[model samples]
Target chain A: MENLRLLFDAPILTVQLLLDGILIGAIFALAAYGMMLVWGVLNIINVAQGELVMLGGYVAFFLFKAGINPLFGVPVAAALLFVVGWLLYRVVIFRIVDKDLFISILATFGLSILIQQLAKVAFSPDVRTPQAGFGTISMFGGAVTVTWIKIISFAAALTTGGVLVWFLRGTRMGQAIRATAQNARAARVMGIDTDRVYAWTFGVNAAICGASGALVAMTYLVDPYIGLPYTIRSFMIVIVAGLGNISAVLATAIGLGAAENISAFLFGAEYQIAFVYGLLVVILISRRIVLARQRRYLA
Target chain B: MSTATGKMALALASAALLFLYGPTGATAQTEGDTINLGAAVSLTGKYSVNGKNTKDGYDLAIKRLNEMGGVKVGGKSYKLKIVYYDDESTPARGAQLAERLINQDGVKFLLGAYSSGLTKAIAPITEKYKVPHVEGNGAARELFTEGYKYLFGVLSTSDYYLRDAVNMAAEVAKENGRDPKSMKIAMAFENDPFSLDVRAGILEAAKKHGMKVLVDDKLPPEINDMAATLTKVKAVKPDLLLVSGHEKGATLLVRQTSEMKIDVPIVATTHCDSAKIAETMGKQAEGILCASQWDRTLAYKDKWFGSADDYAKTFQKEFNYPAPYQAAESTASVLVFADAFQRAGSLDPAKVRDAIAKTDVMTFYGPIKFDETGKNTKKPMVLYQVQGGDYKVVFPSKWAETKIKYPRKLPTN
Candidate 1:
């Protein structure tokens, strides 16, 4: 009977952990969704995508200083970043989209360094966050704690993700985008303006990144160097979700979050993040092995 | 062709001599009349808070000094210009920056990096260059033990600050009528060199008091989970919890502990003395105590220390936030440097080092004196508690500008 009671209590904690994970995972999903969309359409990884998110957070923070609510500042950040992204695409990424993959990665990596250094000079290296009340709240038997800004942020991430998923599946423009992803040459031969599509894809991807960054600021504090970690996490999420599947991204996020929570509960909090990174490494290795076998069999 | 080869050989030999044995080292004062100051700081990484603040403080001091007049070098007035480089918080970067500063910038005086790791890494370079270095804000005791006569530090060792907390805790326990010796102490410290030094101080103090150490967990800087550690802490049920780390890491540990329904008398070091803690933790921060050299409410009554009140006011007016330890260290560094400059009576690096080694300067905090080893003498420690979303100094009743209502629990409006 005592064991039964303990077992029953575990579910409440587990569910509470899951909810916390889902809300936090929503932000990760949004971050990964942008990566997927850009890679699918433009065939460029957008290495500086995390910095775009960081830039968006800074934009929203400043706008908040200008007496605008951070939530309201989200679209403003996205719009401004859209222009920035459009320029970057036109000047930098646009030229290299046709270049070799290695060259494109290297160029974007250089762009990341430039953006990071500029951010370091412009924004004081000290961290800043919007004044959002994110105190804990109790729900059910187990307490679910999150910032109010994070609650709103998670909702926004989910809404954006849902809308993007719908657009990709249902819209005519999204269809053209998918067609271009499948075969860019064929799509171009069929009268699609592939270059324009690529440009729009870059802007849209940046907008997603900007919005995600704006939302992330409510949950996490950002220093100038937060870009590298965000980039690593996004890459991990994308790889874990198995490339292009948005649904799989969400699933992987939930699993990753729950694993961190469990690790926190079992081990010291220091090891919780280590658990996620470890999982990412293991997943990638096993996936590589599986791919190698498949290639060998095909040969 | 043979005559040309001989001329080329002569030129190459001269270049090698200059490169291997510094050409500029021979000249006591160059035609440029410039005294180069080498600085390596984390102007871009996580430690940039103190790094950039130190830079700003150094600049402000230089600006004020030059405006008043220039540093007297020989008989001529030499304007001070710092040749600072970003170390990026990496050892290799620190060494490289140090090399560039000494070899390229021709800096005769060096200021060590913000953290102890960077400081220790660049110490060899300073030795190699034979330049006098003033260690800025890197509080590890190992820097002092390096046996380098050129390296002089202005800040008190982390051991001194951490010991201040343990001593204050003992006093608090005795005042509360608990047998101080019987008190079980649990300590959680960041795994960084600063916190390790602090932990060593705590252990030394604990042994002095014969107090029982129930739990000792040293955590890394990037710990995202602390629940298990807290669980161990709860099992031990120590009378006091000494949690130490950077701002976010400390705050997260406290928050996680609260979520686990673990509440004990928690005392943190200067790392927790910021508006960031109260803003993030809210009610969870209540009753949490800490010790620092300066608090915002310090009245500028002491003439020797200048005006902490004015400094605080100016900082807040400019930054739109309360001045934390970073600002305090910056202001303190400037005050120490200026005092040393005055006592030295010249911009000669050796003389300045000698002056800093010997002179006692009155500053905003109090009468500042450095012993031969370069730790601050007469360091006044203030104890503070988070009371209803505000940090109030309540201990050492002489300086208790405000009373902290202790054991303040949750649902405190």
Candidate 2:
């Protein structure tokens, strides 16, 4: 009898979970886009990508404290993060651009720890959310309920993605960035300043992270330790979607989000992280095997 | 595998491992004007918030002790001093710092680290070194099951966190002429020791009180989202929503619950009394219930901080925020140390350990009585409702200030 009730209730629950996953997955996609841009252009796996998101969250946090509407925190956080990203590149990324790939990973990992500690000192360790007070709207006679802030965050992510695509396709700097990303030596030979392009790409990446962080601050709770998970999720999304594939990245992230939500439901929340990493491992291994088979056939 | 060469190689590996992580030598004992209490506080990492609060609690206790004519031991009056280092919220770092404090600093007495994980790490060091560690924050039941005589916990074990809340909710249900057996609960918690212990207690209490558990979910370790679980909650519409996911989980649950409008009769959680939840959620915080180990509204008093209300006022005046239960328990840990030191009448570690083992007294925080497991078994957990801006105790009528506002009314604007 109990089983029958649960079985009957499964449909509405599934619909609600699906909506929640896509909305949250949109945020994941936005944060992952930032990761993809930096990775594609710089060829450096930024272990501290999540820290930038954390810093962005802090920007929104302070702005909200200063009595600005938390919604306005989105753009303000972006602009501030742009400056931060530029500074980080000039000081750290510039010097280590030509170092061994392993060296960059280790350095960025250390940078991640440094960022977490700094946020702890600056913001204190209390968990905080800026409470946009957007309220909620029920759907399907309360079978599904959607928070307004989540909707706004999802819409903002789409708009940001749209703007980024337009800028990349139309602007000269975007073309230069693309050229540098494709062939840095050829772009430099063509009189394009590769160094400036790299810095701008990193800065824009940071700005994207900042905007994502503000939305997160409104939608989810922010803590100093929340960074590394975001970094890992973005990395997973990029890997699953492939580098420099923005539209695919967005689609894959939503898919991953829905999958995660469903898994969280079926397997319980304790296994959610393990499930994600497990999925990443499985995907990578299968991709490797497929490539090996393709290489044999080609030979 | 058991050949002579293999044995020799195994011995060499063991030696190398020991050399890498073995205990260092303790400096010569120096009895001076101050008694140094070493602590590996998580001051610079994930546990930094509670760590800072714990440190402030220690600092306040030490300051008050000095002002009131410090600990008198064996015809000598000595001031209390804390020698603390940031553990960075890592178990390994906490253990390493504990070793350094015990060996390099020659500090035999110890204070607890912030979270249960850190405390678990630091406990073994105290046991090996024969140091008396009085920890106020770490309350996981696993900490005491090791049977370490030298370690003591000042706070009640996490098993009692929701015991009172479940019982009171059952009682409140009876008062409203609702069937206790018909009352359903939705439980979600992080898969950590503290929260797991809380989950265990809620399950037991619910079973004992004849309440049906509609949903029991263990939140993911990183805890990024609660939407899926809250969605299930909305589907079931349980009469009570019980959660025990520490600070971050608690705040997220409250915010999302209000946003989703999963209007249960009660929204009781383990950490809602925290300023993080109360201050962040503001008006949405009203009517939420929290299972608190100690509340300022409780009718308790002591010579040091006077009543619970006085402690709140004094703590706010000094620290610029109302002291949470962590701070209160940390302060009580210090007081327990002081009480033991006075009773022991000497600075000897063994004597202090024995004195602490036999402690049966009361303070502003609660009664300080330890069972054989070194846990304060006498302290009863209290239930507090987030009424306006305060965590008002609303259970066990003797300690309660106001009757529990039955059937938590969600604000509809």
Candidate 3:
């Protein structure tokens, strides 16, 4: 009977769950967008994506420790990450840029381990939250509550996504990168420096990860081992949405978040990751079947 | 070619040097002047925080022992030295390190690693070698059921870790004019041995009291954001929200509770001050309660370490951080071994094991008496409530220092 009463209160609960899911999903979308940029242009799936996010979170934590607001630390981390990304490209990534997919995966996976170890040494394996000092606001007559930091992070993610979209559509470097991603041979024949584009594209993805990490530090907390989940989540999001489709990516991110939140509530939290990986397997097989059907008429 | 030759030569020289100095000198111990204690601790990785605390605890104990003229055994005094290895919180690595400590380091006395999983791995190695292992932290009762004669824990077993939390919840429920059977409690525990034991205990206790489990969930293995769990917790609106998410889960619960204002009457968790919740969360963690193995404010004391308060003050002076329960229990483990060593009056492992089997001494971390299963049977559980950035006892009528703000009101600031 009490459970039935909860069913009557479903509207308000749904609103709160959806709001929480969508906001957190925005952060996931930002991370997925970075994955899309690197995968579309460079044809490399960066397994170290989460490590970069973890690193950026450390940057935000340091800034927060220095008495800077975590909200303002976003761009600072992004800028720092851009430098790190560029350095990574010059040092290790550029060599593997034209390598086999498996080799690239191995290298980046190793890189993730190295970065995680370094962070463990530097930060000492503690879950630290960058204090937002922002309180909560009640919505729908106290049926729902939202933290101001989540709102700030959500807006930051949306604005960062919007700015990236605008930059891709409006800038020359972005056009060259898009051209390279669309047809590398043709772009190279057109005298475009595709190497430079690849470097900049990788750097931009890292910057995106750094910004997302800063936001995550405020909304959630940061840990050295917390990187792999972000990487796996971004990979799943990119696959579900299809690479380079910004709008689709955003929608899929929210969908994934909603699925996770709802599953956590319904099946309890233990099975939440199982549902996520299970969803990923289902999406891949179903998408393969759909593509197989699409090719049957031609065959 | 020359560079390769140079590198090979360097490697060969390093290997020879290692062989000469080797990791362990176990066989040399009888001839040597010092008693060696081998420790496989998680000095790095996720469990490092507690592991470090355990290390500091051992360090303080050893230093204090030396100050008191060390341990007298068989007509001679020998100072204690720990031959430590960093397990990085991996169970396989911890077991391997324990073996290495026995084989390479040749240490007879063993200190258990931090988490239950690591301790489980190390326990069998100690049993096989018949090395007397005195573990401080790993509280899961599962570690004892294997019936390793060589293994003993100074801290009480894990099922009892959260037993005090459950009893207090019922007490608080009754005080609030609510029936224990009518009250609902939600819980989320980490999927580790210690936490699983905690969950089992909480469930059994709740059943005894007839409290309905509103939400019982194991946190997802990898994801740190437990806001999803907290969201459900908000909707359920249970009388008490109990979590055994270890340190990370504890921090997340506190952060999310403050963020979402999930305002349950009581919020209890594992790793109260060990995770430094009061310092980290500040206002957010105020009034939160936890199942504590040892609180510094406890009046329990003995000859070596004085009172629990004295141990905390000394630990703070040395480590510059507040001593968590793990630290206190760790010091007690050392005291247990020393007491056994004194009674045996010998450096022989077998005799020392016999003495340890008959241990019935008191220390800063309660009494160190082990049952047949090698668990500390004398130490009692205490329920602690966070107040003004420190833990205050609120359970067990005798030790009730301050009243728990039942329903736990926040400061008006």
The lDDT ranking, best first, is 2, 3, 1
Model 3 CAPRI rating: acceptable
List where candidate 3 sits over 4 angstroms from the true fold. A1-9, B1-133, B175-178, B312-327, B337-360, B395-397, B410-413
Return the lDDT, model 3, position A108: 94
Give the deviation of candidate 3 from the true structure as CA RMSD: 7.8
For residues B212-286, write the lDDT of model 3, one tens digit per residue.
898888886575777767767777878888888877888888887877778888888888666788887787888
lDDT of each: 0.69, 0.85, 0.85
Stretches of candidate 2 above 4 Å error? A1-8, A285-299, B1-138, B148-154, B301-306, B310-363, B368-374
| Candidate 1 wrong stretches, greater than 4 Å | A1-19, A74-76, A139-151, A264-269, A288-299, B1-138, B148-154, B179-191, B202-264, B267-291, B295-364, B367-374, B377-380, B383-400, B411-413
Which of 2 and 3 is ahead in TM-score? 3
Kindly give the stretch of ten consecutive residues in candidate 3 chain B with the minimal lDDT sum: B23-32
Candidate 1 per-residue C-alpha lDDT over B1-413 given as tens digits, one digit per residue, 9 for 90 to 100: 69999999999999988786663553432336555566888888778777877776566556655665656644566666677788887888999988887776666677667877887888888777667777657778887776776676666677765676667667777778877798788777777777788788889988898888877776756543454456555555677678777665556555655555555664455466653666555676777777666666665333323476666655666566666555566556655555666667676667777876775765555456666666665555666777777778775555567765544353321
lDDT per residue (tens digit) for residues B1-413 in model 2: 66998999999999998775554333223346788888989889778889999999999899999999998988889888899899999999999999999877778799999988899989999999899999999988899889999999978899888877888888888888988898888989888777889888888999998999988888876786887788777777898888888888788877877777778888888776554577767877778888777878788888888998898888899999988888999999999999999999877888899999999877888888999999998888887788886677887667789988878888552
DockQ of each: 0.11, 0.40, 0.41
Ranking by TM-score: 3, 2, 1
lDDT for position B316 in model 1: 61
lDDT of 1 by residue, A55-88 (tens): 8888777876687777765787788887888888
Report the candidate with higher DockQ, 1 versus 2.
Answer: 2
Worst 10 contiguous positions by lDDT, candidate 3 chain A? A1-10
